[model samples]
Target chain A: GAGVSQSPRYKVAKRGQDVALRCDPISGHVSLFWYQQALGQGPEFLTYFQNEAQLDKSGLPSDRFFAERPEGSVSTLKIQRTQQEDSAVYLCASSLSPPHMYMNTEAFFGQGTRLTVV
Target chain B: SQQGEEDPQALSIQEGENATMNCSYKTSINNLQWYRQNSGRGLVHLILIRSNEREKHSGRLRVTLDTSKKSSSLLITASRAADTASYFCATDVEAYKYIFGTGTRLKVLA
Candidate 1:
């Protein structure tokens, strides 16, 4: 598919466990973003990557949340010692141009990975 | 910490009626975008309005931005059942970062 792709559409894990989610952004995209959406709520920004560099992670709720986009293509979000509050749909999106450009291009989104903590 | 907040958390309207949802932000923004999300699905971009632009339209979707009030409104004309979904407003304050509103759950009854 030409759009962004996310791995493991659904995941279930016990509390205090660890999990990793993967995202494959559109080829040649310069900016990628990760968002978390709780049940019946809007998607909240989690982190952003401009190529291999993590530009911003201010939205990350805690240090337990980590994300990396090594080599500037595929990205991974890892949650260490996942808590019930960490359970939500993780969405990956990519835009063709860098955010600073201030272009009107829209970002493409993936199906997202839903994580459930028991 | 959310920058944008939407009004009428939930709205119900008959199909063919126009639906309007409003969003307000706390700070200055470069651009504001609207997105739709179906149940259990990722968000799909609907429209983007820059701070300098007051209005934009895409097919049946119309967006108006009031920078003076730090607000924006999305109007969907001739709504359909397929339009039933959650609508959110996101403000782009900086590069690659978007602060989203709580969202408005719109239910278009057929």
Candidate 2:
């Protein structure tokens, strides 16, 4: 697609329920990222993937939060045994490549998955 | 933990007025980026200024970075009601990690 796309715009899950949110990055984009945004706060980094390999998952809140870019194009963030604290907007973003040496490689974001744990 | 902190958690301004937001970071960054979000939706990239380059402009958006002070400022000229949104500052640390700040909520009243 032209922009990053995320599935289940809104998800209401009961405590202990497992929920999966999906993301389809822009075609041919090699870098993908997942972030968690709590109410009245900035999006916190959850994980990053370069192609199909997850380069970083240090920011995932806990074991309950798992993310994968199986084919490097589509990605999923799964939260198992969802807790109330897990309620937030899960955002997916993709970029052409690392901006380290590149002049500009801005991230394109998805509308985000709003997950509510009841 | 966040690498940057934004000042003035919220701001209310009249239309046509200029709006300014500031962000301060702790570590060295390859570049600093500004993004805008409306009603908690997806964020749109506004502008980016490299660490070596002090300033950059995009449309009415002007961004200035002070690597020595580890701070950056975003200025929106002649803000409009449509400009109301949450503005966040992110820093690309090392090569991969992009750390975001708390963000500044801007309200431009018409």
Tell me the lDDT of model 1 at B108: 97
On DockQ, the leading prediction is 2
For B1-110, candidate 2 gives per-residue lDDT tens digits of 76589988899999999999999999988888999999958999998888888889999999999999999999999999999999999998757678999999999999
DockQ of each: 0.75, 0.76
RMSD value for candidate 2 = 1.0
Give the docking tier of candidate 1.
medium
Superposed Cα deviation of residue B109, candidate 2 (Å):
1.0
Tell me model 1's lDDT, rounded to 2 decimals: 0.91
Task: Quote model 1's iRMS.
Answer: 1.4
TM-score for model 1? 0.97
Residue B66 accuracy (lDDT) in model 1: 97
lDDT of 1 by residue, B1-106 (tens): 6758898899999999999999999888888999999988888999988888999999999999999999999999999999999999999877577888999999
Q: Taking chain A by itself, what TM-score does each prediction score?
A: 0.96, 0.96
Give the poorly placed runs of model 1, Cα more than 4 Å off. Answer: none
